[model samples]
Structures are given as C-alpha cells and as structure tokens.
Target: MSTMDYDEHESKFMRKARENPFVPAGMAGFVGIVAFGLLKLRSRGNTKMSVHLIHMRVAAQGCVVGAMTIGVIYSMYRDYVLKPMEEQKALNHK
Candidate 1:
C-alpha cells in the first residue's frame, strides 16, 4: 500500500480504538505477552516447547480477560458515576 493508504488505515484503526479502548488494550497485552514468551523460550534438556506454548497461550488469554474486566469497570464508572454527576451539574446550572 502507498503511504497515504497506510495513513488512512492507521487513522481508521485509531478511531476504532478510541471508540472502544479495551480492544487495543487486549491486543497489546496479548502481543506483548506472546513476544515475551517467545523471547524466553529455550529448548533445553527437560523442557518441552509445547508446554511453554500452552503457558504462553494461557498468559495471553489472562491478559485479555484482565483487559475486559477493566473495560467493564470503566464503563460502569462512566455510566453510573460520571454521567449522573454531569446530569446533576447541568440541573444545578439551569
């Protein structure tokens, strides 16, 4: 793709990320954990690559689940706490 096309695609991705920040957070967490796992992997005497792979998979899944949990908490705080405060402030002003 050309530079302009790449820029457009990046912008679209950023817009989507802003709309739902958890997706990017989860993706970043998964990628980061996987990269770390790959870097740490060593095929030595008693260790199996399959076992390491399974551990990495589980860690990545945990990262995604953590991100989802945080996202839900943030949504709840925004809706239940911040929104009502804003509404109350608006009512006070009127």
Candidate 2:
C-alpha cells in the first residue's frame, strides 16, 4: 500500500487500542493474579521453584480469561444498552 494508506491504517489501529475498555482491566487482573500467586507460593515455603513457576503461569492464564470475559460482558452492555440511551438523549436535546 501507499505511505498514506499505511499511515491511516496504523492510526486507526492505535485509536482502537486506546479506546478499548478491556485493556486496563486485563492488565490489572494479570498483575494482581501473578503477584498474588507468587506471594502465596512464597508463603507456603515448601513447593519447588519449578512447580511454583507453573502455578504462576496457570494463574496468569486464568486471569486473562476471567478479565476478558468480564470485559466482553461490559462491552456488550455498553454497546447494546448504554450507547443507545446516550444517543437518544443527545438527539432529544438537539
């Protein structure tokens, strides 16, 4: 593609990424799950390092799935219900 077309596509992607509502939730969930898992493993003080690392990986994956599920539900609600109501309000105000 031409330079202009590439630039436009890149900007559109960047804008969508910025506007994505799930990003913050997913990041927070991932960090919290991994941190908690590590802390719990440390406290237990009996598990092998390899086992602990495996558990951490599992926790992180679970966090991603859980966060994505929550984000999808919220996004669906916002798109189906909240956005329509807000648009109607704005239209009525005009």
TM-score of every model versus the real structure: 0.77, 0.55
Q: How many residue pairs collide in each prediction?
A: 0, 0
In model 1, the runs with Cα more than 4 Å from the true position are 1-10, 43-45
lDDT tens digits by residue: candidate 2, 47-90: 88888889888878887888778878888998999999999999
Spell out the clash pairs found in candidate 2: none
Writing each residue's lDDT as its tens digit, candidate 1 over 16-67 gives 6875799899999999999999888864347788888898999999999999
lDDT of each: 0.87, 0.77
Best by lDDT: 1
RMSD of each: 5.9, 5.1
For model 2, the local distance difference test gives 0.77
